[model samples]
Target: MLAETARPTAAPPTPPRLGFLRGWDTAIIAAVLVSILVASLTVEGFASPRNTGFLLIDMIPILLLALPMTLIILTGEIDLSVASIAGFISCLFGALWSSGLPLETIIPLCLLLGAVSGAVNGFLVSVVGLPSLAVTIGTLALYRGLAFVVLGDQAVTSFPRAITTALQAKIGATGIPVWIIPVLLLALVFGVVLHFTGFGRSLFAIGYSEDAARFAGITVARTKFWLFVASGAIAALVGIWWTLRYGSARGDNATGLELSVIAAVLLGGVSIFGGKGNLPGVIAGVALLAILRNALQLASVPEDTLSMLTGGLLIAAVVAPNAIVWGRTLRRKPHTT
Candidate 1:
């Protein structure tokens, strides 16, 4: 008789647990709450809707830039050319508009220029296999130089008042600007894309191990190339929005804006080395910076102090993750009994 063997029933699968808060996210949430409270209490006029609306308006561009910045950083890559791309697009927009190109054609053409600029950065990084840092840095200079060549120390400040009126239009009695709508919508889209989609999971995989991800058939190169392209496109749009919002477009517009976006992303707890973080955390990060900046401005604090805070935040973002990893390693090491 064949030995009647009873196969053991497979153990029941563990149910998936839903988790939203992780790592520094909880801390950032608390900090944001505390900041709002403190700012309202200590800074006169801080709680006023008009000021709040203005603060939100100023933050809109950074908020937009931070979305893709979060994604790029998630893939263990950086795109430092974003600010330069914005500046370049602004220059291109001014040059085209001044040359009497219709607003419609000028906008699309500027966006195309942004895409082409991003493609160049992606080509060098992905196809040529250059380090992302090196590639973006080089393109950073190249794009900024192109911006200078395009505008040549000129500024365009005569955009239609209607554009600004529409963009800066107050959202009813709330006193909040309409620009926040796009920021929120984009945030929702990014949050869903990163958290719920296969493509988003592939980004994490690439970040953790590109070779293994490639073996799993994730298109790392294509994915990264598109990321840079998206970043450039959004940044270009920011340039246009900024131009209209302030009624000015210059080659040097949004200069050094990249630092704020980078700091916010890092402060949001996205791993600088990659493969971690969420949109909520990033939003908190952006809010934190905006609150501090608005409060300090209200309190007559010098800009230098604000710069110091930014520097400190950037440093913390870099150090915190490695510190946690080191602690984990220590815990995992078996003690000699």
Candidate 2:
């Protein structure tokens, strides 16, 4: 009698929902596909495997630098000197090669220099307590100037064909360089670290607010220091790679590259306010950029026009979310009496 007195009903199940592409990642991916289709249809030889190899080759440096840049931005910081660091590494590489040092020896040395350069920035921003933007801007000029001092307008093109050939070689019929695989590998590592670990969660917390992260015992300064060092080291590595891939080393190599990296990172849906980003989105954003630039170049678009387009994309990235929020506010009506 007691058990039959009352029968309890179970709660209804929650509705199935779509979470993929809940942000700009899907848009970027779609844009990439569309650009590829258009380029293939209109630009003669645009869809050729060789052209794709060149495209992926050109993207390696930018894509490599963008990885560390994503982490730095996630912590609400910036590194404007990435390109400069790369240039400096390239210049130093040429100088060292001219001095008869082995390429193998030069590679590790240049990487060391990169780490040190980044450590300097980290010290200034994390320990000295300077604003990241200002510090990086100052170092940008400093590193670039050092590169000029090292190379003095000279270009070194005496690299061995073996290395260059290896770098330039195609991977099977995929038209992707041997180096392009590294980008995917790094992205996978970064994605895992940022999405599936406490360290990555800490980055978000720091980006949300350093003060809060500190309260949570997250070691904000130490994390930032490492991030900058990683950025600098990766940048330096990119510089070296760029030199080898192009068969030339110059102080001004990769000039203005930082802008493109920053633009792509922001465009990937990593909010300017920090604590809002994902590696998949960043990859999509970078791919979109590469695709657009490649397509436009095939169509003989002016360099200025490309710059304008990049600028427009960046502006939209910054504005679109805010505009959406504003619209939602406006559309909401007050409760009636």
Candidate 3:
């Protein structure tokens, strides 16, 4: 006698819970609020639309680079060569156009060059199994040196007037500069990718543990390689913007900018060692730095003091979180009887 089997019911799937904020995001948000308050209080002309427009315009490149910088850090890699890549691409675009290459041709070629640089860095790190720190540091020098080799002491100033005017022009209605449009667009795109996409989740997983992530079917090497490529491409785009805005390209332009880029990324909340951070935090970090710089300039603060302030902020950003993490770990230990 075959008895009818009892019907089985499946348990309902659990809803996802809200995740708590990471250290970097919290710090950046707080810093941003404080910066706004301080700027408003200290600088008489600080809250004007013109100053705000200038601040936003100046922030575009730094904010743009910080987007990919956040991703790279999240995936547990670093690219110290970004500033150099920017300089090199700037030189390449300028040299090509100066030598009579069409703007359309030079632009695509510059982007391709940046992508190749990133691919090489990715290969060195992933295929050759070199540490990112060592590889990027070496490439940083090599790329910047190549920039010098390409342009030497010469600068390129002659560019299409239309391109320059379009990029640097301010909008009449809001008084916001056109240069800031790219920054806003890229930031929105990256924010969506990081927070709302499966790829973003994969990045966090890979950042946590590459071997474990691979076991879970994530493409660690490929994703990381593409990450570097994207970073290179973005850096190149930043170079193009700089050339258009300044109407010139020099091998030394944006030199030592890597520090600020990293500083902005780290300050935004992504851990230096990897595995935690988000775009909102990074945007806040960028805003905070930009506002501080803008306000200080208005206050007539010395440039040297500003440099020192930034250095101190970077050090504190790196050190404070580690100290807190360690403190919590120690506190959780049970006392010996």
lDDT (0 to 1) per candidate:
0.83, 0.83, 0.80
Off by over 4 Å in 2: 1-20, 332-337
Provide the lDDT at 183 for model 1: 79
- Candidate 2 lDDT, tens digit per residue, 1-337? 0011121232212211222267456777777788889889988888999999988887888788889888888788889999999999999999999999997899999999999999999999889988888999999999999999998988999999998899888889978788788778988898888877888888877777666677778898899999999999999899998899888999899998998888888878776766667777777788788888888888899999999888887788778866866788988968679
Q: Please report how far candidate 3 places residue 274 from its true position, in Å.
A: 0.9
CA lDDT, candidate 2, residue 178: 83
Ranking by lDDT: 2, 1, 3
Colliding pairs, model 3: 24-269
Per-residue alpha-carbon lDDT of candidate 1 for residues 259-329, written as tens digits (9 for 90 to 100): 88999998888877666677788888998988998999999999899888888888987788669878999
Which of the two candidates, 2 or 3, achieves a greater TM-score against the reference?
Answer: 2
Listed per model in order, the count of residue pairs whose N, CA or C atoms clash below 3 Å is 0, 0, 1
TM-score ranking, best first: 1, 2, 3
> Could you tell me how far off, in angstroms, the CA of residue 295 lies in candidate 3 after the best superposition?
1.5
Error of 3 at 182 (Å): 3.6
How many residue pairs in model 3 have overlapping backbones?
1
Summarize candidate 3's per-residue lDDT along 257-289 as a digit string, tens digits. Answer: 777888888777677766667788778878888
Indicate the residue-level lDDT of 277 in model 1.
70
